[model samples]
Target: MPDNVPMEQAAILADAVSTPFGAVVHTEVRVGESVGVRGAGGVGTHVVQIARLVGATPVIVMDVNDEVLQRSLDLGADHAFRSDDPALQAKVAEKPYLNRT
Candidate 1:
């Protein structure tokens, strides 16, 4: 644990960040790569930040909740979409930046 982090917050912080950090590391996300996270809850939110921290570009988030989607954007996601949208796939496909050849 870092000296800057308060002890009271350590466990919660680790629990929140560990899985996402591991997942991002395990996937070997490269700089400038586009990342799409499929949820916007606790773990998903952390994934967005970790991806961004590792230099992933155009980090996109998908979730059913409008508030959660917006929150993802605020947290570091370049784009957010409602998973329940019937046009979600089309919308994502239309984003030219996401379709790197």
Candidate 2:
């Protein structure tokens, strides 16, 4: 209900902003933590942005589409991978963030 956002756009905007933020809040994500999001679609993209904004480092995004993976990186994910990759687990484990004792 902001002065700038038209009423017609309000619902969509609210959904776009709230869903990801709510998920982040519910999960209690902390600064410098590694975040791995499984999807890079509409709401998943926003999750990447929100995770980065909250200071999560090495934000990893996984999706089946190469384009989506790239988009996640562009949106501030530290790493992107195809969810269907046979080596997905190994690849994710290789990140330095997850190696910490």
Candidate 3:
């Protein structure tokens, strides 16, 4: 936070940082596609929830457990797949390529 910002908001910003293994529940932490934070678990669940909140379309959640796969879909994921699934790639790429200027 800038020096001109309110102390309360600065305190809120200060609360955002945490170590992964040391994170406490009910506290928000940043975890955007980092090295060890790929697959869905505790922190990963928070990732999914935030992604859903922000309207990430065609959210493909990959996991081996049937129950967890189902849970991903129920949690607003557009699709879920096992790692070795034959159709996973195709299913994820249903739409044609888009040109970026």
Candidate achieving the largest TM-score: 2
Q: What is the lDDT of residue 14 in candidate 3?
A: 38
- lDDT (tens digit, per residue) of candidate 2 on 6-100: 88788766777789999888899999987889998888999999999999987999999999999999999999999999999999887767865
Q: What's each prediction's TM-score? A: 0.85, 0.86, 0.50
Clashes of 3: 0
lDDT of 3 by residue, 1-101 (tens): 57899997666433333222233223433333212123555544444555655444545577667777777678766666775678866755563432225
Task: Give candidate 2's error at residue 71 in angstroms.
Answer: 0.9
lDDT of 1 at 14: 73
| Clash number for each model | 0, 0, 0
lDDT of 1 by residue, 1-101 (tens): 88998887888677678989998999999999989999879889999999999999989999999999999999899999999999999999999896556
By TM-score rank, best first, the candidates go: 2, 1, 3
Q: Candidates' lDDT values, in order?
A: 0.92, 0.90, 0.52
Give the lowest summed-lDDT range of ten residues in model 1: 8-17
Q: Per-residue lDDT for 30 in model 1? A: 93
